[model samples]
Target: MYTISTKLKVILVLVGALCFSVTVALAQGPGFDEDVEDVPVPFDGGVTFITALAAGYGIKKIREHKEKTK
Candidate 1:
């Protein structure tokens, strides 16, 4: 049978706990009201910056892996 390492087990538990906590917090928060009008979310530069950073990091890792294999 396959076995999981302690580090992986701890990581999984922490992730599960975080997801559970977030779910509880969101459930307790204020919900939509029919009387109140919906507001549009403004475009944020931070999201674009993060997306670009992630894409660049992925490209860099892929290039590194290709070089290593060669």
Candidate 2:
């Protein structure tokens, strides 16, 4: 189990809330046309690799933080 300090938890919650709100806004008020064509190909190998790297880094950071608290 991980124990997060009150301040750290509050900060994390605020940041997550901000991110969630921003994502919701972007999704709701889309500037891009849904019927638009000629869009670039979706998610080549490089994009997949980058996404995997980001997820791995986030998991590693969380694990390290938990270890430190222990």
User: Over 4 Å off in model 2, which ranges?
Assistant: 1-42
Q: All candidates' lDDT scores?
A: 0.91, 0.88
Q: Write the per-residue lDDT of candidate 1 for residues 1-70, one digit (tens) a residue.
A: 1356877888999999999999989888577788998889977999999999999999999999999999
In model 1, pairs of residues that clash are: none
Over 1-70, each residue of candidate 2 has an lDDT whose tens digit, in order, gives: 2456877898999999999999888887546777778768776799889999999999999999999999
In model 2, the Cα lDDT at residue 41 comes to 73
